[model samples]
Target: MAGTIQQIAELAGVSRGTVDRALNNRGRINPEVAKKIEQIADEIGYVPKHRKKADDTVKQAGRGKRIGVVTQLSQSSFMLQVNKGIRDASKKLADQGIEVLVKENASVDEAEQMQAITELEEEGIDALAVMPVDCDNVRVKLNELTEEKNIPVVTFNSDIVGTKRYCFVGLNNWQSGQTAAGLMGLMMRGKGKVLVITGYFSNSAGSRRVDGFVEELKKNFPEMDLVGVQSSFDHTDEVEKIIVNAMSAFPDLEGIFVASGGQAGVKKAFDKLDLHKRPYVIIYDLTPKNEKALLEGTVDFLIDQEGYDQGYRALSILSDMLRRGRTPEKEYMYTEINIKTKYNLN
Candidate 1:
């Protein structure tokens, strides 16, 4: 039987990536480990799998080969940055003859997303990258696009669970939320009424973040009172109204966790209340609004999910999958979860 990289790695007790590097004569590896990997390959009569260079495939697929990217442009600055990342990557790949088409929607409407995706498919894109909406209809559409049409789909930023997309490229939203909660608890000294403002309840990412925040608060800060959870739908007005109502209802609220967009609106509401002592605020994303809020003392902490990397990697991974027949080792490729504070603005 011909030996695969995995087989060689197991016999030689090394990682598949190390074995690949040793066999391919690429990357740095210890001489002894490289020799052992080579010997194992020879002992097993290993036949190297024919790998078409991704660059060659991109070149051959040639001019007019297109990748479609769909995301919400008006939702927040974060989404806008994600869009920029996609465009940046597209520019990098343009010289290689691959064109990137972007479809932007102003809101998180499932119908709008579904329509955009369907239109992209109709436009004959070779592959797709999307910031998915968590809805049954949308998931079904993605599944059909991948399973039926054989067109690869990679999701970025927000992910839709139970989809046939190749992989999810984003942060572990639950962990990010937990980190936010911990920061809030620490800032409030572990005891206070807490209110959580979530983005879209239907989306798995938002729900997971809220769930993680609530769970961590309950487990670690039992004294902290969870006032309520409000879905903002990433709308500024909605976030403002919700924050005002929650503050009015819970005057003792000492901490506010903005789990998604609308930080500007939340800041406005906080300003309106004119509390002598404002609630400790923790927001997600390091957008212009959040950055200002952090610097000006409106927001205490910010959790950023490297939006640019998410977009770039999603497109890059899908391109590699189509060009080289490579599958991501894991279903989820999580970006780094970075915590930002006023002292460390960079």
Candidate 2:
């Protein structure tokens, strides 16, 4: 026999009313609790008699509503997880008759993002989710979209200020930077030279992270000298070149902090140098490459920004707004700043 709602409620340890709300998507319930109830329902093969009908109604109501998404640095390794989240959410939204149009840019170019936004606007997008370039033009465009056109916007991964974005979904980059500094300080034992490598100066995410790391290093680890700070533009070759040059300039460098992509270059630099003792290195993202490096003892730490959640929740929030007039519970939906080491790799 198919499991009943009562059985599901009992299994989930929730009231029947709460189960009904979660399964039917009718009322406000904690997202975690709703997820738990849904998981239990799936496990028990419990299907509500009206579920198909309710889904069909949602699909019909979602028809003709479109959400536009724009992402920067699509080629970066970290973006793989983020893009996966976007694609997953897009499929779910598509099942409900909502369209998610995505435009991926290869670089953090403000003009390119503005052009993409213009194209999506021409396509009659009802809402927008973007990884905006931190520039005056992009900020102005976002403001226009939210205020003049009345199109709700959600910024993910990277954000811009001075705009009426519905909410932001990503890491607290500054705090992550501070975390990196603290880890490096521990590894370096308080006094040594450290090098900093960043993706791009114009990117707010990278810039803020660098700022936080520098501030924390100055505050908590004043004895440690910052040997060099360089931008790699998220290119492996550039990162390798920067590392090689910095190593040449400061052979006694005791630590390194990478606030953005192109971490593969760090390994390349080590291999090329064939140093008997490598510097204590901390990089961002838990991508396969970074994971491998951690396992192989190349990187000391990895700070993951929950890339998948950043992509998924940004679209999900917009979908709720378009479908059910739901507003985000918080103005800033920061993802967890997870620290990954070899021992805890899972």
| Top candidate by lDDT | 2
Top-scoring candidate (TM-score): 2
TM-score of each: 0.81, 0.88
> How well is each residue in 121-236 modelled by candidate 2, as lDDT tens digits?
99999999999999999999999999999899999988788899999899998899999999999999999999999998889999989999999999999999998789999998
Worst 10-residue lDDT window, candidate 2: 23-32
The sequence of per-residue lDDT tens digits that candidate 1 reaches over residues 1-346 is 6778899999999999999876553433554576688779878987444232434665675554679999864557788668766776676445445678889988778899999998998888989998888888998988998999888999888788788888888999989888988888888899889899888887677788998999999899999999889888878888889888988888888988888877788778977888888888888887887888888998888898888777767776765565557777788888888999999987
Off by over 4 Å in 1: 1-64, 73-75
Clash pairs, model 2 backbone: none
lDDT of each: 0.80, 0.88
lDDT of 1 at 246: 88
